[model samples]
Structures are given as C-alpha cells and as structure tokens.
Target chain A: MSEAKTSANPLFLREEELRQGIELLFFAYRDFTSEADAMLAKHKFGRAHHRVIYFVGRHPRISVSDLLDILAITKQSLSRVLSQLVTDGFIIQHRGPRDGRQRLLELTEKGVEMERQLTEAQRRRFARAYREAGAEAVEGFRKVMLGIVDDPARERFAQSRRDGGRDGGRERDQ
Target chain B: MSEAKTSANPLFLREEELRQGIELLFFAYRDFTSEADAMLAKHKFGRAHHRVIYFVGRHPRISVSDLLDILAITKQSLSRVLSQLVTDGFIIQHRGPRDGRQRLLELTEKGVEMERQLTEAQRRRFARAYREAGAEAVEGFRKVMLGIVDDPARERFAQSRRDGGRDGGRERDQ
Candidate 1:
C-alpha cells in the first residue's frame, strides 16, 4: 500500500485519504437511503422492496432472471418481496412474448406513482449536490463512481443511461 | 421537477443526469460492500455486524448511545449485533472513565485484525479509483459526497479527518 508513496508518482497515496473515502461512502450512502427507508417503512416495505421498484421502474418488462442477476439475491428471497409487490398491485408480471415460460416484471400505475415519490426525494438531494458542486465536480463524481462499479455490470449500467428517462426500457435481454 | 429546467439559472437540470446519479449510487455502493459481505458471511456475520465492528474500530471508546445515533438503528436491533460481536470476542465494552455507568466500546486485537482486512479491501478499490480519476477528480468526488452527508454529521466527519487515521477517539459525548 505504501509502495505508491515511495515511487515518484505525483499522486499522494495516503492511508488517511483512503480511510476518509471509505467513511464518505458509508455516511453518504446511509443518508442517501434514509429518506426512502422512512417512507418505505410506512408501507411496510424494506430496502429490498425499494430496489425492486426502482429497477422495474427503470427497465420495464425486465425478466425475473435479469432482476435476480442485477440484485444478486436468491430466487427464494426475491420471491417473497416480489410476491408482496404483485399482491399489493404495485408490480405486475407478464409472460414473455417470445418466450412464454419467462416472467417479465413491470410496475403498475400505483407502482409508478410510488417510484416517482421515492425518486423525487433522492433527486432533490442529488440536484442540490450537483448544483453546489458544479458541472466539473459532478462529472468527476460520476467518473470516480463509475470506476468503482464491477467490470461486467458497467456496460449494462451505461446501456441504462443511454435508454434515458422513465419510459425507455427497450433493451430487452429476453 | 421540470420547474428547475424552466428556471433562468444556468444549471442544465436534466432529469437524465439525476437518474444516472441514482443508478451510479446504487451500483457503486452495492459493489463497494460486496467484498465485505462475503467476508462477514464466512463468520456467520452480516452487514450489521460489519457496521458495529467498523464504528467501534474507527472510534475507540465510542459510547453506546453515540454508536446507536451514528447507526440510526434501534437499541433492540443494535443489542443483537453487539451481543454477537462481544460474544465472538471481536469487541469489548469498557466502563467510561468519567462515567462508570456508560459503556465505551472498542475492538479487541482479533477485532482490529478483522477490521484491517475488511478496510484493506475497500481501501484498495478506493485507491484504484482515485488513481485512475486523478487528484482533481478525487477532490471533486469528495466534495460532492460531503455535500450529500447531513449537516451535523459532516462536522464530525471533518473532525475525524483532522485527527488523522484512527487512535483519536477522544471526543467523548457521554
């Protein structure tokens, strides 16, 4: 770890900075999810539910396997949360058109409303941060975070970005 | 939400950018904790256990209430995780010097070793991201993340940075 410091590299490889980075991620992520958590609690939903709603809202007609791959949770675990969403009328499942056996998930109208509310709270924070940090800082922030994502998933993330806002979920991997 | 767009301010206020920010956080945080979660599972522990060990490691002699406040978890929820840590000899609670009734928590030698291993994994990822993104980007990343943290905690975070790398947990709020 100290090797980077010993070399003539312009970068300062201080352990202190590394630790601060870790703490920033911890506190920032905690505060980021907090508001959504409070609102989810009112509906008796957990963070897991929020993830499902957000993803389904982003990529409509997302297959169960794809969601499992994205969330990286067991089918058994997802079954309980997904079932609750379906029963509560926030999520609906449709049989894949090309493959009848596959179950593709989408948010109901109510689910869209819920997703909008939760997302609005988060966007407010991000918007404020972006406005304060300036465009250059926002770009730097995105570059650093994008660098942190796992290699394989980076492409999928970029694809989602290109797909743009709520309505465009065209990249069906069914 | 589009009100910001129609404003005379120079900020772009694009919804696409805001959505990308949300996804970046989700993917980045998920990948950030993946290594720790795997390591914790080997010991039959979870993220909650990791948080207990992390805070106790960072703030040696941290009081119970302070830990509870930082974690924002109920006393009941914290009790289960704390008991497991103590039982496993990862953390030891000492009587506060000024107030014997108050329990101050710190990591045992075994706990320190575990915390080091966990933190090293995270540090490596952060270091790589920092190096790739350059110093300016690193500063920008920190600025934006700091902006996201709630106001009160931000002061404590900065104080911890000034204290420089662990061992200075002297600000007792008992």
Candidate 2:
C-alpha cells in the first residue's frame, strides 16, 4: 500500500490515503443510512427489509430471481423478510403474466409511500452533499464510487442514469 | 423533486440526478463490503463483528463507551458482538492504566491478523478507485463523502485524515 508514497505529482493513492478513503466510506454510509434505519426500526424491519423495499420500488415487477441476484442474498434468507413484508401489506408479489411460475415483485401503495419516505430522506442528504461540493465534485464522487462498484451492476446502474430516472417497470427483464 | 428537471445548464442537480446518486451509493457500498462479508461469514460472524474487530484493531485500548459512541449502537447491542469477539479470542479487555474503572479493549494477535486481511481487501478496492479516478477526482470523492458524513464524525474524520492515518489509540479521547 505504501508502494507509491514517495511519488510526486501529489497523487493521493498511498497507504495512508487509501485507509482514509476506507474510513470515509464507513462514516459516510453510516450517516446516510442512520435515518432510514431508525424509520425501519419503527416498522420492526431491518436493513435487509429496506433493501427489498427500495429495489421493489425502483424496479416494479422485478422478478424474484432478479431481486435475489441484485441483493445477492440466498432465497431462504430473502424469503423470511420478504414474506413478512408481503404479510404486512408492504409488498405484493404476483405471478408473471407470461409465466405462471415466475414471481414478480412490486411495492404496494403503502410500500411506495414507505419507499418514498425512506428514499426522500436519503436523497435529501445526497443533494445537500452535491450542492455543497458543486457539479464537478459530484462527478468525481460518482467516478470514484462507480469504480468501487463491480461490473455489470455498474453498467446497469449507468444505464439507469442515462435513462434519466425513469425507474421501475420499464426494464423489468420480462 | 422534479423542480429542476428542465434546467439548461445540464446541472445534474435535479431529482433525476439525486436519485441516481442514491442508487450509486447503494451499489458502491454493497460491492465494497461484499467480499469482507463473505470472509466474515465463513467464520459464522457478521458485519457487527467485523466492525468491532476493525475498530479494535484501529484503536488499541479503546474503552467500551468510546466504541459505543463510534458505532452509534446500543450498549446491549455492542455488548453481544463484543463479548462474542472476546470469547472467540479476537479481542482483549483491560483496565485503563489511568482509569481502573474504564474497560479498555484491544485486538489479539489473531484479531489483528484478521483485521489486516479484512482491511487489505477493502483498501485494494479503494486504491483501485482512487487510481482509476486520479488525484483530482479523489478530492471530489472525499468532498462528496465528507458532505454525507454528519457533524463531529466528519470533523473527527478530518482530523484523522490530517493526522496521516496513525489511527486508533492516539485519538482515543481519553
């Protein structure tokens, strides 16, 4: 990690800088989710539940397999929280129109409301960050974060960005 | 949210861009932690355990209260993970030299080894992100992330940044 410590050009990729990057990520993520976490706790749900809600809201009719892939969680693990959400009227899963065996997930109106509240809280924080940093800094932030994102997910996300925020149901991988 | 959707400067500060930023954070953090998560899971441990080990490794002789503050979790919640780590020989507790009543914590050699492995994985990703984005973009990433970080933590983190990653015990807030 210290391999490049002595290099000029003021490059900040040394071990020290790298560790700072890691710590910043930890602190930033904690603050970003802290609010929504408290909100989820009020519903007796956890971060896993929040992930399901946010994704279902973002990609209406996203299939169970697709969601599992996106969340990278096992079926059994996803099932417990998912079943609770459905039972609580937060999400509804329907049989795929084209395939009876396929389960397509969507947020209930109640779920959408919850999603909005959660996402709005997050977006407010992100917007303030962007506003404070200006347009150029925002791009740098995205570039670095996108680099942190693994491929395929990165590509899909970029596509969503290019799509101009037309979220959900539009690209349900039918 | 859509208030600035039609601005002429391509400001990317509208609801669309804001939502995209939110999604980027999700994807980036998931990818960042996924590897370490898998590693921790192999030991039947969870993210909570990882956080305890990482902080203990970083801050030798840190008291229980300071950890609770950094984690922003309940004493009961942290106690479960902390005790588990201690029982598992990953952490050790001692009476603070200056304050016998203060229970100071440090990582065992085994724990330090684990911390190095876990942190090395994360640092590699962050280094690649920094390398890919270059130094100019690195500042942008830090600026945006610092904005996401809430008060006091942000200031504390900046101080650490200025401290050049000496880490832990030096700033134990004794």
Candidate 3:
C-alpha cells in the first residue's frame, strides 16, 4: 500500500506517509506540552500563563500588540492571562520608549525564574531529541518546522532566531 | 555567541539551540492546530472533539481504556467528549466480543467524513512541508518527533505507523 501510494506521486506525497506525519506531530506535541503543563499546574498557572511569560522573556520589552500578533488571541482573552501574570508578579508592563502609547511587556525576576523552570523541562526534552537525531536531522527538523509556520509569521520566526543568535546579551532572562 | 556555545559543548546541547527548538515546536504546533481549530469551530466542536475523532479514526475498534491512555485525559473529561461525539452520530460504541465489559469505539460514516475533512487540511500542510524539506529533512523531522514522545508511547506510535502502512483497509477514515 505504501508502495502504491508512493508510486502514484513522484513528489512522495503519499497519503500513508502524510498520515504518519500528521499523527507524529499530534502525538509528539501532546507529550512535549505535558511536561510544561505539569510544572505550570504546580505554580497555579496554566499553559496560557506559560506562553505569556515565555514570549516576554524571549522578546524583552515586547509591545502588547506584537504579543497579541504572536499569540493570535483576542485582546480580551490576552487581558485575562496578562492580568493574572501581572497580579502574580510574573510579568511587568512598561510604556514603550519610542511610543509611550504602546505598552511593552517584560518578565520580572520571578517571571524569569518561572520561565526558566518551565522551559528547562522542555529544553531537556529537545536537547535529548537533538542529540539523538544528529546535526543533519536537526537541520531537517528546523526546515520542516519553519515550513509549517504561516507565510507572514515565518519571517518573524526567522528574524527571532537571528536576534537570539546575535544579541544574546540584550535579554538577561532568556 | 552560537559558536562559543557550540564549542563549549561537544553534545551540541547548547541552551540557545534548545530554546530555539522549543520555540519552533511552539510556533509550528500553534499554526498547525489553528487550521483545524477553525474548521472544528464551524461545526460547533472544540479541539477535544477533534482529538477523539482523530484517534478513533486512526485506530478503529480501539478500546476505551486504550484511548484514555493515548489521550491522557481524565475519565470525566473523556466521558464528556465521547458522549457528545456518540450522541451526535459521529461515533459508535460497541461491546467487545470477548469481554462484554470493554467498550470499543469506532467512527460512524458521519464521524469518518468529519475526520477526513479535518485531516485533509493538516495533510496538505504536512505535504507542503515534506516536499519543500525533501526526504532527508522529512526523515529528520520524523526522527526528532519520534524521539520527543515518552518511552512507552513511542512504542505505540511506531506500531500505529506500521498499522497504517500495512492495514490500509481499516476504517478508511484516516
């Protein structure tokens, strides 16, 4: 069956292979988030809180609009999570230097600590997978992951990587 | 900075790269699920419903206990989604032939069509990524994704792939 499907498509868009890919993404993601979800539960937080602190830590001084863009959540939805994080002392909001009207988000020391604990669990899992998959596989993994992003967001994703590689000192938390 | 980090570790377990991987997974999974979420929303269904239909579609006649293990959701949580799907004529539950106490789950015609629509959207994304990344990258993508699964689940994941490859006649939903 796999052979027939492969033979039907020179590009190797076999349904069987594609289905496996779909299931792989589903199962792998389920497990990947479980660890961080467990950690967040201990802090009386949820995945939404983890996402807010994570992005803030990664992109220090990120504006609220930019965060909303990244999260693709409604302002009202974000407001609730942002409020919880701020009230819990995990995040700080500041006025943008260039545009005072824009609110910039950042992680406080406590927020940074929470981000570390959450990401540490995920990092260990990723590091192990990277090691097992090797350098070439890692490149392939990156290519596929990048390809999965929507067109407009793909540019932002690439820019973030470049920023992380070059300006490691800009953000002390991440 | 990347060079220094790489040079510092022979295993290539640099924190920077690992963090990038975490973000990649986050961004990719977010985008991937967003497409399906939109489709499910049109049917007045949520992600939980989509997940139940997906796994049941993949593994026909899958036992309730087995599905609970795969989803890792509370019995109450599963009960809610399962009851909804069954009531909506999207799923059919039957007693096990050997053990009458065991409830086996399968997608009805309506359920199968729903699964196909949802999975077809996801498959297009995966196919585009696989084609652009090429076979080697796809191999890497699969390897890394597989490695990320928990130890016990990894075995089930591989078995599912094998099942899909050989027994394509089952359900014909996925």
Give me the runs in candidate 2 sitting further than 4 Å from their true place: A1-13, A165-174, B1-13, B165-174
**Overall local distance difference test of candidate 2:** 0.83
Q: Compared with the true structure, what per-residue lDDT tens digits does model 2 show for residues A1-118? A: 4464444323442766887788788888888898999998998999899999988887778888888888888999999999999999999989988988888899999999999987
TM-score of chain B of each: 0.86, 0.87, 0.85
Chain A fold similarity by TM-score, each prediction: 0.86, 0.86, 0.84
Q: What is the interface RMSD of each candidate, in Å?
A: 3.8, 2.5, 2.8
Question: Judged by lDDT relative to the true structure, which candidate is superior, 1 or 3?
Answer: 1
lDDT of 3 at A136: 93
Q: lDDT tens digits, residues A1-174, model 3?
A: 235443455344377688777777777888999999998899888899889888888788887877887788899989999999999898888876777787788899998988989888889898899889998999999899888878756765565544444334333221
lDDT of 3 by residue, B28-147 (tens): 888888889999999889999999999898778888887887788898999998999999999999988877887889999999999999888888999899989999999998889888
Question: For residues B66-168, what per-residue lDDT tens digits would candidate 1 score against the true structure?
Answer: 8898788899999999999999999999998899888899999999999998777898999899889988998889888988889756765565544463544
Which residue pairs in candidate 3 have backbone atoms (N, alpha carbon, C) closer than 3 angstroms, thus clashing? none
